[model samples]
Target: MPSFTLPRAARITRITRTHKIAVAVLAAAGATSGLAVTSAPDTAQAASEHAPAAVKPVDAKGQPAKADDAKTGRAVTASVADHVKVDSVAKQHSAKQAASRSAERPAVKDYPLSIMKDKGIPGSYEGLHRNIMRESAGDPNAVNGWDVNAVNGTPSKGLLQVIQPTFDTYHVEGTPNKLTDPIANITAAANYAADRYGSIDNVDSAY
Candidate 1:
């Protein structure tokens, strides 16, 4: 079909008294669904008056802007841009948090007891020393020959009698990886005691 636009000046049709009489006759004829051609000029004029505006062209910058489009409503671009900005900030914050945690982690050492202050062990030095003495009599190479751990073939050893598996599980960072090494053994034992019984100083017997 061809589309035609009539000028505003041409839309005001000169209706005659004969047209009104004809409309009354059509109504009396009981027309059901046919167009009332007598009212065509007014309908055309109203449609032209309410027509939408044309889309505007883009400018030089790449940023999204409201196009002068014929749409009466604004585009939903602003909310989408805000969501992108929020996601970028969240990702940056997460990366910074991860970096900070990594920086705070302590490094491994040859002697764990040497880094007592560095590891920030919870109890006093004297208290920890007392617990170590009760467990192993200050001997780093002490071995429990008849204990449950020894019977199971994973014997307890060192200044603090810790079984291999238990020591490995609770082994603190910045400690030597040896069961007989006094500092490593003491630190790992303290860590295990702290986990189970609150602290090594709190253990009154072989825990």
Candidate 2:
């Protein structure tokens, strides 16, 4: 290796070069610091612009309220409750109507004309039926207070219009004592007619 020594001017030149490099480095650092300061606002502005907007919960219809979104579920429950109420009311009304109709049915259908024949009453069914129609219109509870038989205080009553005394006198065996008993009244009246007039079929007027 050859021994070397720097000239004074060369050394000075080298020192000057070093100084220039340091200045340049300082300048670059300053520039970088300035750039950082200037870019801070821009970075913040960019982030603000690109950030997501405030969001709210949406319904199926895209409305922003949670209550509106819950309405569909609420409607299903409400509809079922309403339907149940309606069905209950309808059933109650139907039951009431059926009971009313049953109550309103006429009581005349309780007995039939064939019952008279089965009782062995000696009378044509038509004549007995007509007599019943004229006296009580087939009403089992019919009573007569304005007739001559009732003026003596023992009123005529029941389907056959038999007075109390007559009912008691001619009442047939196996028949009820009550003058208002339909089958009993008919049997007693028929017995009375048969004893007096030979047969009920032979008499249609008051006995």
Candidate 3:
């Protein structure tokens, strides 16, 4: 009655309603397919994130495991067993080295009489020294005033009362005549004494 053609407003409303239904149906179908495809992966991820980490294994009695197990990331086990083994090997090596060195060390010998002779003191000088000590308290100038004509008589000529004959027998080439000259007298006396006794120890004992 108002108009034989549909009104403009009516037509727009019908198109809008059709589009809304189509969109709703498509949205519902998309949601269902997405849930089906992603469900397993989502469940797995959630379990991994929220679940506790795996624990290290323990013995039946709950004691800690051995060191090798600990090194491989297990808990409740000692971590130094390998180090202890290495230390034991090192200690054994050191002990062996020390023993080898001790075996290689040289032995020391006792002092020898030949060595003393080389040092300027002969083996036989011991008795002469003792006699001099007794007669003069070891004084080279000590006199025996009681004896008459005691061979030049100005006390003993040297450490061994060297008189003329003694001096000729044992005097060193460069020595002097004075009895007080310790070097000359000691040299002569040592040589003569050595000739008389086998060794200095024997002379020292007699003195």
Measured by lDDT, the strongest candidate is 2
The list of candidate 3 runs beyond 4 A from truth reads 1-121, 124-129, 147-155, 199-201, 204-207
Question: How many pairs of residues collide in each model?
Answer: 2, 0, 1
- Tens-digit per-residue lDDT, 1-207, candidate 3: 576876999989988999999999999999998888867567778889999986655543465656665456443334345556778999999999999987776321112223334555555334545655654676666555554436355334544454545555866555565445755666565555556764444554322
True lDDT of residue 92, candidate 3: 100
| Error in Å for residue 154 of model 1 | 0.9
Query: All models: lDDT?
Result: 0.71, 0.75, 0.58
lDDT of 1: 0.71
After superposition, candidate 1 runs with Cα above 4 Å error? 1-117
lDDT of 1 by residue, 1-207 (tens): 899977665554434456777898888665533455554568778888888975553322334445442243234344456668889999999999999987776433323444655665544566667877888888889999997888899998988788999888988776688888877787888778778887776877888
TM-score of each: 0.43, 0.42, 0.32
Colliding residue pairs in candidate 1:
55-69, 56-68
Pairs in clash, predicted candidate 2: none
Q: Report model 3's TM-score to 2 decimal places.
A: 0.32
Taking every candidate in turn, the Cα RMSD to the unseen true structure, in Å, is 19.7, 16.0, 17.4
